[model samples]
Target: MATQEEHPLIAEYRRFSPGSETLAERSTAVFPGGDTRSSAHYGPYPLVMDHGSGCHITDVDGHELLDFMNNFTSLIHGHAHPAVVAAVKEQASKGSAYAATSLNQIELAELIVERVPSIEQLRFTSSGTEGTLMAIRCARAATGRQKIMKMEGGYHGSYELAEVSLVPDPNERGSLDAPVSLPIDKSFPESVLRDTVICPYNEPERAEALIDTHAQDVAAVIVEPVLGSMGMLPASHEFLAALRRATERHGIVLIFDEVITLRLGDGGAQSVYGVIPDLTCMGKIIGGGLPVGGVGGKRELMQLFSPSQENPVMHASTFSGNALTMAAGKAAMEAYTGDEVKRINALGERLREGCNHAFQQAGIKGQALGMGSLTNLHIASNGVLHDARDSIAGMIAAGHIPRLLHLCMLRRGVASASRLMFCVSTAMGESEIEQAITALHESLAELGPYVASERPLLVA
Candidate 1:
């Protein structure tokens, strides 16, 4: 009997990065799934990154790719920025971390508090997962409520509650008016599903009703202004405004998980939408490409974590405000001025427009969805995506075509998330944006035959 043949695209990818393929095999001896980080993993295998500088990275095979993924959007200034490098090095000479607060830590916090509209005070954590976890705990402690209201398909962090209904399986997700809380994996406990109230994304009325229904027990309503893992779907102002009104009327804490969306503006999505959240969970770029997280809010709500207060929320982490990360973060934030944000945001718009044109030129059904400096490609012709379900439908129809397109793009020297998510960084200029657009066009041309043969429905 003959063995099943590998897809031509996967075979091409394997050929293009044979060095990475060899390293991936070696990595499996120590790291599970041939990788330590699950989000960064892909098949036939992910590239073995040799080094990165500015907005470009070279794989072990000596192939250079424009770094659009930017380490899952954490490297806002791009890899090994001079300012960030200098700060990290300067701090390293002093010490990496300490048991006490560092000047950089205090300065970074002050900067965040001054910029973000919702964050009056904040406490750092080692990762975004911890940030959201502490935010939930803070709300529960403040409200004495047991339940948390999170949007369907909204991802806060790695925890059970934050990830409840993250994937939104169409079969089990129930009606849009009343989205049932379904776990992305089997690890979720029944109580977590019960404790989490799932509100449909972008449906203002439905979300308002859900909040009203669970007002008594709901401690907080946590949402992302632009749903990150859900194809970068931006929440409508009406939807976010509705949530704010509903949560306020119920006296429930309103938390904005701006972990990915913080780069959208000087004060994040809150300032852009003019919808103030009671609490905000942040990470990603704020850490200056290091591990970090933070939960901040109105002084009254944030005071819960104050050690000076009675029975404080018990916030403590070994590396929360370590000197090295703080120095790097401070330098990153300082370099990421308001003008740089605007410039990168314009590049994002240009990329999206160019991508949409490429899909049309290739006669493939697809579009780019996102806000400001963040963007995601979906294999759908849908005009405006309001929620995850809309994006998922396209993913289902395209089958393996999107993955094929990703591999093709990589061969063309552009790197994005395996899911086709792209982001613009300060290090990227108009030229880099154009380079990625050209790569996308070429990749789409390569995949046109596959779409027409295997996924005809995706043909424009």
Candidate 2:
């Protein structure tokens, strides 16, 4: 809920987007909280987008805003790329899905196998949630173990165990050495918490020690190279290497959840870090703006899903590897070459640098921290953010400033994740990057007085 003091910004937003406000009010009659997806929802209400082209999305009020969020970094080519649209149209005319395998599915899988080092064989699912769930099941079947070790802030999917200790509350998270498995909400079962071991992000020695203690019952150790929900904090090579060494020593399957981080390079973050995992779970950009998920690994492990196996992992989904998604994904991935990856990554650096400078110029205690096409804003004293705890502390200290800033940016003709995560798409260029930076400068200027009065600590 928004506080009374936040009404000014909320009022300004409502005034600017009266059409969206009406739509949101009407939506509450059907959808819960005026929105169906929780991640896309914000405090006041989200802008209802009508259509998108290139990097610009027009809301219902006909406001053409630059789309930096890219549908939470899934739309790598931004909205409706010609090639992707062509492929989807062609496939849709034939048929959306089929009970048997299709050529597009085989082609996309081959492309992925040729690119990613960790995935020798793979299977698709309807969403990233299913991808991670299947990966965990595969590990348990192979190792005959019940426990799964995951990072404190790492988010795999929507499932219970995948979300264990997702938000590291400073109060309930216990100590740095031994973090408690805290749930995001009351829906989580106690059994999920017990089965999950929470490892501190970016802490190498502590993670190794935890793995050593629970090596016996642990089936798999899953991690994201770049922690997505926790402010896009990138994991250190040493920390990932530590996980690899420990998991290899214990004979535990190591899984890398590269759903969001696959945009980092041609072969994903595992290629960037040179620390390979036994199983790699993927989604986001791989789906080419469609709902898709996949998990792949060494032949020995992935073969467990083979029907020929006496007792396979038992994976089945109605829309897994559907024709329309496969066609779209193939076209999108084909266009996303190594050169394109390099270009967008350079743009990401430009965005982060410009945003950081904007914060300094506005005299605000904030900074942009992320790597290669992904950026997240946080309020901090030293601009030094290491983990979820650091990111959440900065958020708590800033009160409602972050939410206000999001609205201010949207009004200034820029759109990002409500939490302030930004990414570069193929449709964006240096001009769009500069536009976002300029919007940040103006938004901060508007909010400067409010921060000084209500949140003095945030006024640097």
Candidate 3:
């Protein structure tokens, strides 16, 4: 048994992080919970970041730590890369937003269209949320269908339609054969819920059956190739193939929500699986650490957005394709190449391997799961998980251990998502990966006894 003061769990989190705590208090006066994003929050408080350079972020508390959150996987090249910084600085003087089109927007779009095979035409939006919204609307318009299909645990954005059936209770989620659409929040209208058909992830036969059953009314089937919010669960190639075949047979627009997963590779997750969707919703890395989103697809489907076309789907955003974000995105994308993507993805694999080793050494039932440059830590020893239900169960069983582990890592000069999902950046190298591994080892050792004692359920 460890002494109270000597316990690594309690001892490691005692450092003064006043800058973050103080700023959090001040922010609470205006923003709920002193933060805008619920995913970024952690117990005791999150670090108030002052600035970031390369893979390091300096918190207002003056503590320097390696950043793995990467602004929720938006900073593909890491903070303020020379190219992006120079572009933004140069473009800021030229003008940020203009009612008219700009050359930078055209260049960025051309780059994306050239890289993503399925996207022959594309349009920019202010956020991934908007990009998804537009994709759904376009699907509806193109097919004249009202219903949509989405994975039970897949998250697209904040809209009611996109968020439907996101967090279904096990009791209400129906069986694996036929899933039920469970509302994520009460704010969702009954009509929206009724229009969404929920399908299980990684279950190809079940998904195909569901899509076939609803083919006539379903306009689109939106999925994240790698489910980001649900611990980065990658969809099986068979599952995605089933979707492609079913949607093609039924004339349903298949949408890939790569908003977060776009950073995975040069061609994105689509390239990895060799399965292409009719429409791809993208954001994050494309913005170069700025706010931006996009929806792109085959020229035929994208032509529905043409202003010159009669009764085109209406879409507009004051900040969409703003010159500043466009310039930064162009610079960032230019800096990233196929080789760079492969290198960063290799680093992510290293991080995951190190984390798995740490869990084994600590005699804990935890595992790191993810693909390419994105990864997440699951506090379970149950091998691999296929869906969100398994992820939630692992988290629930861990009690406060996961949160405590996050705090411990922060104090040890490392930062990952509060939920323990992390992504590698181009700015990070082997040294940073090793630092994260060392921190994980220390945090696990710190929390080991408690997990073995109080959270006995977590022990394998």
Estimate every model's Cα lDDT from 0 to 1: 0.91, 0.93, 0.88
- Structural similarity to truth (TM-score) of each candidate: 0.98, 0.98, 0.96
Runs in model 1 lying further than 4 Å from the true structure: 1-4
Local error of candidate 3 at residue 369 (angstroms): 0.7
Cα lDDT of candidate 3 equals 0.88
lDDT (10s digit) by residue, model 2, range 303-420: 9999999999999899999999999999999999999999999999999999999999999999899999999988655457788788778878877889999999999999999999
Off by over 4 Å in 2: 1-6
Evaluated at residue 147, the lDDT of candidate 2 is 97
lDDT for model 1 = 0.91
Give per-residue CA lDDT, model 3, range 254-357, as digits (tens).
Answer: 99999988877787899889999999999989999999999999999999999999999999889999999999999999888999999999999999999999
TM-score of 2: 0.98
Sort by lDDT, best first: what order? 2, 1, 3
